[model samples]
Target chain A: MSTALAPARTGSDERLTGFAGEPLDQRRYRRMRFIRRFEETLLQLFEEGALNGTTHACIGQEADAVAVIEHLAEGDHIFSNHRCHGHYLAHSGDALGLLAEIMGKEAGVCRGMGGSQHICAPGFKSNGVQGGIVPNAAGIALANQLSGNDAVSVVFIGDGTLGEGVVYETLNMAALWKLPLLVVCEDNRWAQSTPIAANLAGDMAARFAAFGVPVREVDSTDVEELSAIAGEEVGLVRAGAGPRVLLIHTYRLCHHSKSDDERPEREIADRWLVEPLLVHGQRLDEADRRRIDDEVETALGEVVATARALP
Target chain B: MIFAKELGDTLRGALTDDPRVVLLGEDIADPYGGAFKVTRGLSTAFPQRVRTTPISEGAIAGVSAGLALAGYRPIAEVMFGDFLTLMFDQVVNHIAKYQAMYAGQATCPVVVRAATGGHRGYGPTHSQSLEKHFLGVPHLRVVAASLFHDPREVFSDFLGRDEPVLYVEHKLLYPQHLTLPVNGRIGDLLATSEGGPLPTVRLSAVPVEDCTVSVLAYGYQAMLAAKVIERLAMEEEIFAELLVPAQIAPMDWAPVERSVAVTGRLVTVEEGADGWSWGTEAASVISRRLFGRLRRPVDVVASEATVIPSSKTKEASILVGSAQIEAAIRAAAR
Candidate 1:
């Protein structure tokens, strides 16, 4: 029931300390770190040309995926956009299938037909499409409404996706029908090298609020904070409070994809401002941070070894 | 008897029978009912299951696909077949490719119902038999019901299957009623007659059992072919069996091949423009496989290769009818 927007604490160390005091378990932190490492390895693979097609690594924006996924039940659904590796991993999608999909192998989630752009997990009934999954998530939420179930549908979109007409259309319908849906905009300053100022005009949170839907903004780097806010909002939706929007402020650390090499100073400055992993890691003590880093490296190393072993 | 009313009753019965079934479309509710009245009284009968949606065709199809993925058998209506173009992406890319693209991991068991064909004078925008647009999708089923009984039956079958279905209904034939034989139950239609007991019929010098002419006629065209056969019976003593293919894509070819074997000739009749239509594809398939059994070349009776004319006289002239089918049948017979 708390509608108070937590003020953005300055300094990575202070933010991390604040998050550590919150209720995130070590296992969840380890998982978030594992996603960051896995994404870093994926970027390396893409650099070596081992993986085909475009890869949108959620390198810096790990907290958004981790936090939002923590609020979802196993039966609830997650509809992800193209930049979905973190979301997919956080939602319990298979690592081997994710790697195989990136490699365009038959073992991939989409059977190599969709490459990394459209991987889906049948078990969870959760899937990822480029920009097409925006309206699709609303449709799924509508289904949950018709079924009269408390299952909440979450749609993860980047700042760039707000430009799409379908996304707004979906948001309007979700609000109009008072459907149980959570629209999480991972506002990672840059949408494929384009800054939010250059692309999006006007305030994003206010845009949804104007449509009569409650809107909230949070720091995407703090997993514990993000999880708390997301969990409360999801609960409200389940209680028939209608659709809500969470504009999570995050950063995309890497270049848009392997193809883009434009690492301008402005981009680097923007990345440093909201470096999600660095900011989240800085909060823990030196020993705890080192332990988390080692665990993440080992886990990612096993995944890389397994992916390489595939024939 | 399985008349149009019975068809609606059967659909209502099936909806009430299954918890997974849900219906959505324009004017599908009670009072005004559907435009064709096929879903009459369904909304009130099953208030929770049957829903009337806004006139957003793309959203209708997309929602159905999503619901199907979420384990619901959603039967969505597009009001008219011509409006299907608006949801082409949802139907062809999303619903059709779900199973194939996902490597059989997921299935979309959604059924899309649309009233197709000309004769309502709704002109080009409203009237079109465009099921051919969905012909070769890997994991989709295209079922057109010419008779009233088959709609409920085919719909029930589609609900049980794990593939998406484009269930096309002809607007012109909705009023043309056909009576079910005595002792025939609604359950009989629900059963997929795949490779069932073959009908014994005499064909040109040979006593054929199960032949496949791929007599690819759907909706009103199928009824027209049957009428043509009736007229042929009166004019000549020749008994040319008509194969009305209720299921087109992922076609149940066993019955069709059985019908074609004895006849050794394939004749297709369709109301759509001839080029690349279902009739054309059926002709090609028959000619290729049944070439050895065939005594003569395959013949196709379809509408002229032009847009549907607006004038009644021009429309009648351009549209292929029983006479053309009769001529085609005779040509293939010889």
Candidate 2:
């Protein structure tokens, strides 16, 4: 399993380090790179038919998962949509268990019952569903409030999931009850093949703001920016300031899945071709970039080598 | 005879006995105490446990599912069972699918309580037996607690198990009652009752020990089935074993299968529409499993597959009574 590599360190470097001066340490950076490589490898295996079933790869949305998950404590809850490989990995889920789940193995996270779309790790109490777990997360947030626990419930959804009526209903109730919830919307500009501008009418942030929720928007590609904003938002929710929505503008470098090929639309593909890992890597100097690249490649190489050795 | 008041008291006592049990519903708090007064004084007794929620059926079901996931046994009420349709997403998709879809990642030990069935002209919106809607959803245990004694036992059994349960209480039977065996506590039946003149005829009794026929009945049909048994005993010297399953979804097949093995005949009676009813499904199961049991085919006595009429004449024509049950039993015997 391997991912196609983009040209390293070629894009605009000035705008990248503007937010929070790259707060990620070597360990965190290595972890995020691990997620990026893991997702890319999964996509390759899916295309090769080595892995069965469809997977929603978090190619460019790694920062959002990492940042939001970093703010969560061990007992904190997370609910994710179909595009949740990053969220599952960043929350310390078992890589083999997740892979097996996607492959429909009995040793999967849900014992092969729930496929790639329905991965749930009971240890972390993290669930992956197709926008249906939004209200369930709100209920979990309410439970946290009822129990007087400072733990927060975070739900990661796409801009398309906002179109679901239950999400809005859950938002309304979450706000009314002052539940500790963080609804992170990864606005990656496309809901499958359709563009978000063509589908959504008004501002996504304004909609949540209208519900009296403290809403924020950040550069979803920048790990530091997402971390800072997510930290602030998590604090606000933990302090009983009700539910909040963070609209993170990210990019989906790959197709929605291996089955979906969007290369026919060159203009659209070109516009959305912001490689998140390369962009983040470019912000650092030559030494930092080399160190990060080596670390990422070594970890990915180990994973691939290990995966191949499994019977 | 223990009435609805005693039943309510019994439930309150049970809740008091178990701290893990929590109740949430509309108007279940102090002063209001449930529409049918089943949860009367429960909120005051267990203030933190008994909670009142806004009229959000989806949230009610979802919250109960969450609490169950968190290891708290939550019994959520939908006030009227008709309103449960509003929460079909959470109940069917989330709560029911947790065990199977999650491969038992977490047990949804939640009980959804609601009052259902047509009685006292509550109109089309309020009066409906919608248990058939949730008949096939996996991992959800549906319990229709009609009699006072069976309800306590069913509730106890449901709470004892680590599965999501849909406890459907009849709106009309709320005022009715039955004398429980031990201080209003219905003990579990060790084996089904057998031993009547016909060997297939069994008595329809709550706090049932052992029975032969596994007579399936619920709501008003349950009372009618008891009367039919009594009349049969006096006139024809025929007795039929009755198995009133409090739980419906995972239809407690143990007793039902055992009863079928003994009697080799099964009769299902319901006061709901006949098309694709629970009775029909029960008949199918019995026929498939006990096909070579050397008796007659399973019989289903249910209401006509039509809209319940408002007029007395039309309603009587559409409804299933004791006579229909008796006829169904006779057909099964043949």
Candidate 3:
């Protein structure tokens, strides 16, 4: 498992200390790197035929998973769909267990029952199908409401997932019930091969607004800005304001999967120019950047060795 | 005939007693009391937990799965049995598979209550019995209660369990008063009638020694089967033992196997269509597990494979009757 944003038991750094109740930007930075490294490792394992099934790598969508999830408390549940490696790594931080699951090992989080597509643990659950997790996530929110707990439920869906009818059905119910839910839709331009523009009709804002849910969308590639907006929105839901939707306009640099290379070369080339890591790193001082880079490198090296040594 | 209101009272009792039990379905709320009135006064009694969802069958059942995972035992009622098809994917894929698939990481303690069977003139969509569609799903408990059995106990029992259960009810069985022996498999009713709890009620047609065949049944068919047993005792003096399995999936086969073991003949009855019904499963169990003890081939009484027509005559022709049970028993005995 990658200890990216580990529990407070770890010793604090002297130069850039993240003490109790402090904003952990450095920690989230490492978490994103961990997800990036984990997905890269998954690709290599897939190439070597070490993994059983094909994985929908969230390589470029790391910022969307981290920025939103970073605001949630430990007890808050996250329901995930196909492209969920980043979400699992962000929430559970169990990269090795995820790798073990990809390899079909009994020691995996779901006991080798659920692989990359179907990963679930304590406080986190996922399924393979798009639009499948949203309804259940609403139920989890209802559970929180019934139990009188302030905990919120978040579901990670994509722009293309709106093509599924159940998402609208679930949205209507969630809004009607006044359940505490945060619906995060990562719009990465393309939906596998087909673009979201071709299938989805109607104004996105009006669709959710009519359901009585507050909708917010960020077109920026900056992770910190995304995090700040999400934190405020999460606070609103936590304060009994009902469900909210965070529509993130991000881009995926990697192919949808290992087999996917049908995307236009020019389109892929343009997207790489404004990818997250380089742009996001320029904000921090050179010393802080190097520190995070060194920590992430050491963690990735150890993560690879631990994943390979398991079986 | 035992009326179905007693069953309603039983469900009401569970809600009143336990805080975790919540009744959800179409028109289950005040003034409506459910389409069949099975959940009458439940919303009035427990308003917070009980709710009338917006006819979204898939989401209603899907939400129940979430509610169960979150700790409350959600009783999701699909007004008619046919609508359960809309949510069958959630029932079969998520609710049933969650506990087993996630290795206990998730549990769906949901009891899906539906009115199933074809005696009413409601047509193919509204009146068909589709329990067979979900008969063999793993980790899902299939229970169909008749008037003779304790509907209260059935709801309370499955409500307390950790896994998901599909509890099927027949519309006609509701207005009828239930009648069955307290204890024993087939003929041991007199012995078990003395004392103790009856989880697996096997009302005897006659004493074990006098019994000619063991009739295995559940749901509404239990009444038809009981009628046949009564007539067989009076007209032919050919006694047959009846086995009403309260729990269908992972069936309580001990008393059933014992009944067939003594009687040397076995017959299974169900309201679902003939192909791949619970009766087929019972017949298979008898042939494979108790073949040596059987004196003849096992018989199954089930509705024929066809759409349930709206006309009264057409409906009667398709559904199994006491006459069918009687014939099956006579053939098994011979």
DockQ list for all candidates = 0.37, 0.40, 0.66
Cα misplacement distance, residue A143 of candidate 3 (Å): 1.6
Judged by DockQ, which candidate is best?
Answer: 3
Query: Between candidates 1 and 2, which one is better according to DockQ?
Result: 2
> Candidate 1: misplaced stretches above 4 Å?
A1-29, A52-54, A104-115, A122-132, A160-169, A187-212, A217-225, A249-251, A261-265, B1-3, B179-215, B237-239, B292-296, B330-334
lDDT of 1 by residue, A1-311 (tens): 22232211232122221243443555456657767777888888988888887887887788887777766764577877777788877766366678887888777777787666566773243344333565566667777888888888888888887776546655665676787888888887777767788989998888788778898888657777787898788888877899998888877777777757465777677767756666666666778768767756765667667777776
Ranked candidates (DockQ, high to low): 3, 2, 1
| DockQ, cand. 1 | 0.37
Interface root-mean-square deviation of model 2 in angstroms is 2.3
By TM-score, the best candidate is: 3
What does chain B score (TM) in every candidate?
0.87, 0.83, 0.93
Candidate 2 structure lDDT: 0.69
Residue A125 in model 2: lDDT: 44
- Compute the lDDT of residue B113 as modeled in candidate 1: 84
Model 2 interface CAPRI class:
acceptable
Candidate 2 per-residue lDDT, tens place, B1-334, comes to: 4345765776686688876667878888979888888888888888877888777777777767776776677888888888989888888878888777888777778788878877455656676678888888877777776552345555667777887878777776776766333432233212233222111222443323233345777655675676676566557656566656555666656667776787777888887778798988988888887889837777787788777666666666677777788888766654
Model 2 spans with C-alpha error above 4 angstroms? A1-28, A122-129, A201-203, A261-275, B1-7, B10-20, B148-150, B181-214, B235-238, B257-264, B292-295, B310-313, B330-334
> How does model 1 fare in lDDT?
0.69
Q: What is the TM-score of each candidate against the true structure?
A: 0.85, 0.85, 0.92
